[model samples]
Target: MTPPTGTPRPAQAAEAPARGSRLRKATALGLAAGLAATGIALSTEMTAGAAAQGSLPAGTQLYKDPNSQVVRWVAAHPGDSRQPIIARRIASQPQAVWFSNYSPSTVTNDVKAVTTAAAAGGQVPVLAVYEIPNRDCGGASAGGAPDLASYDAWVRNFAAGLGSGQSIVILEPDSIALTTCLSAQQQSDRFASLSRAGAAIHAAAPHAKVYMDGGHSAWNSAPEQASRLRTAGILTSADGLFTNVSNFNTTANEVNFAKNVLAALGNPGNLHAVVDTSRNGNGPAGGGAWCDPSGRAIGAYPTTNTGDPAIDAFLWVKPPGEADGCAGPAGTFLPDVAYALASAGASDPTTPPPTTAPPTTTPPTTAPPTTAPPTTAPPTTAPPTTAPPTGAACSVSYKIASAWSGGFTTDVTVRNTGSAAVNGWSLKWAFPGDQQITSAWNAKTTQSGANVTATDLGYNAAVPVGGSTGFGFQGTGSNTASPTAFTLNGTVCTVS
Candidate 1:
């Protein structure tokens, strides 16, 4: 999922008059402290379920919609080297159907197609209703219905397609969280529209569950955000709020912040929330580096059984592999990034953990008798001419171009020290910790276990003696150390 274009502002100093706001502020502070201490604990609960049921949670009724861009990519590019990994890691997983376009003529039919299929399959489909006026504050993901009346008509058409089936509707991304840029009147109008949209969807499909947007934890203070949610009619218009859609905040932090927000709303009818755990395996990188930053890993697989009562489900709201504007055009699917996210070893059981063996004890051994041999004469014939070097002896240099909390971008240079040229080369290294490559350029890269291998692209394979070639990558981890060792064609290289 692409992050909103406008940057999140600091929390305003103006205090909310509601007593509930004061209580929520105090509770959120405590939860934030706990999140800081624990960080993100690796959980296998969701992974185990996905593996058993071919990527869907076992015994869960959430729909695994067959229509997704990644699924289509896999079908079209069967011969691409990255196809299998992308298919296994992302295409197989369930994600939301995003209706970003404003097509009044076909919107109803499009929504009906997905809901009808899922209903027949005895499952619930997730719909991301993103056509809000002035969406993303007229930034990158901008464009929605022209005005309030148009938006109301659009929502009506979209809801008509629900077909009385179970559906989870994500109202709009960045509509509430990024409202500081809007005027007071505009903000009020937007909130009213959201409330009406939720009511419209429910009227069409009584079984539908609508979750309004609540941005990520990093964007707004919990009390302020809770106040906004309450004003948006969260109590009567929707089931609950959803957080971290197309953002990188960790689940632990989002869960804590969400609970605080709900508590501030006085837990209206014991309302709960769902989290977008699409690409937050490593959590947010510091400094708001949101547009296609490198090093991000896919988070937990989508599952209805999220273990936490307040958290209804962990859904993949933003599909992996889609660029957030910088890597490619915004929303374009890049297979290289998809493969990197999949191979990052977050939930991959095929990646073996580092092992430790017991130390071995050696028995005593006697030294052989020292015997002095007679001197030998020089060889009669001259030594055969030394053979020419056959392969390149390469060395690699790594540098951190930029870094944030959970992710960083790096540049790697491969130099040939040998006398001969290398027609083809494969550079390999093993991460010292949980670091994983999320995106790469100038070369093709793959990962297994802690090891990463980058093969030269067709245009840059050959490296002449004393010449060099290079590639770049983005990965996730904090305080990442340089790779301990590097090898070229199985031969160890000197790291610098």
Candidate 2:
């Protein structure tokens, strides 16, 4: 795998938009309100300004991808203190803006600001419908939508702000699978709200595609989740089901599990999936906990160029820098930790944080090698039917709510939502309208015509079941329109 060459964040000026643009949305979701392609869109101004900000960037794919043995080696041996920033630089991907931790009104403005910026930058923005009732399902990060009416209203407001096009929405976490945690009545209420939310988004922004959460592979099996989605009116109301948001499952496992879920959903032509590549570099292991787990680097960001049929693009839905509960509080931001994460390439921290000090303070010979086991697994349910094969005509029949930073990276992430492993994988696409590939990671990439593709190597072949690998890279560009169409393994991952 190649190493990343992306630079560090530059000092910011006042966050403002030029001519005819809306003032920057001061909401937590605000920034360019403009998201990026490959689903890794973020607001640098938001992240930089906050005492503790949590957001992934456009080329987060490259920053998060662990495609570099060189960077990995340097990271593994942080010999001196300078390595943290070096690690951050080494881990650098295209950055994004954020707007989390805002009040309802602020969220509205945040969304609007980012959207405006995205339009100005011509980049697509990544929107997460996190305000669901009992959102965390009472888990550690357990806090979300308090009521259906309010939840629906929030989604409605969010939907209303979709500026023109080039936006991706990852709606609700633990909304579907955690149904078991709630009463039948409660589940019904939330699903009804989600159904309404999906419909509203589609209606308000027909150009914007909204995806429902499918949980992670560890939580729900495809068929089971499919049943939940069907009940939630996924087939009829939303674009398709989403998996691995805010969790650390591998892309391979997510791919297989998603394919199974789609199969259970009658494999509708309007179905597809998005994998959360914010983390999961080594794939989830050592019991499923999402707290900046050990050995977890970044996974693939958004991409229309995946080599699968059933999957659309792998996205960084869970804003990377945010804490996954367990640490301090859920969704809260911690900059020192962020700096540490940036430095060590922030793979999952399997054991708890060191009590006394960082490993560097202690003697190297005394320190334990800090690698954690993986946490990959198959879908929780048995497939009712055989899953789709690798590169086969994917049954993806949904519009991709995507984010992109132009082209491929060395350290990339790919999942096999289809039944079989991709015999070989190559993501290729031409720049749409004003967009272009700025950088890539985790894999070698090449561009011809408008077509650009990233090819995986032996170490990163056929994403293992429910497993995700992150790669990194660097490039140059300016345009920012989310790719509308993509082909996985030659077959198109299209909206029905």
lDDT of 1: 0.64
Once model 1 is optimally superposed onto the true structure by TM-score, how far is the C-alpha of residue 48 displaced, in angstroms? Answer: 42
Compared with the true structure, what per-residue lDDT tens digits does model 2 show for residues 163-279?
Answer: 566566666655676654566556666666676777777666665656787766776556666766765667656667677766667789888888888887887776677676655
Each candidate structure's TM-score, on Cα atoms with residue i matched to residue i, is: 0.64, 0.52
Each model's lDDT comes to 0.64, 0.47
| Candidate whose lDDT is highest | 1
Residue 8 lDDT, candidate 2, scale 0-100: 20
| Per-residue lDDT over 463-489 for candidate 1, one digit per residue giving the tens place of the 0 to 100 score | 778878777776898758888799887
Candidate 2, residue 13: CA error in Å?
Answer: 24
Candidate 1 all-Cα RMSD: 17.2
Give candidate 2 regions above 4 Å deviation: 1-102, 332-496
lDDT of 2 at 175: 66
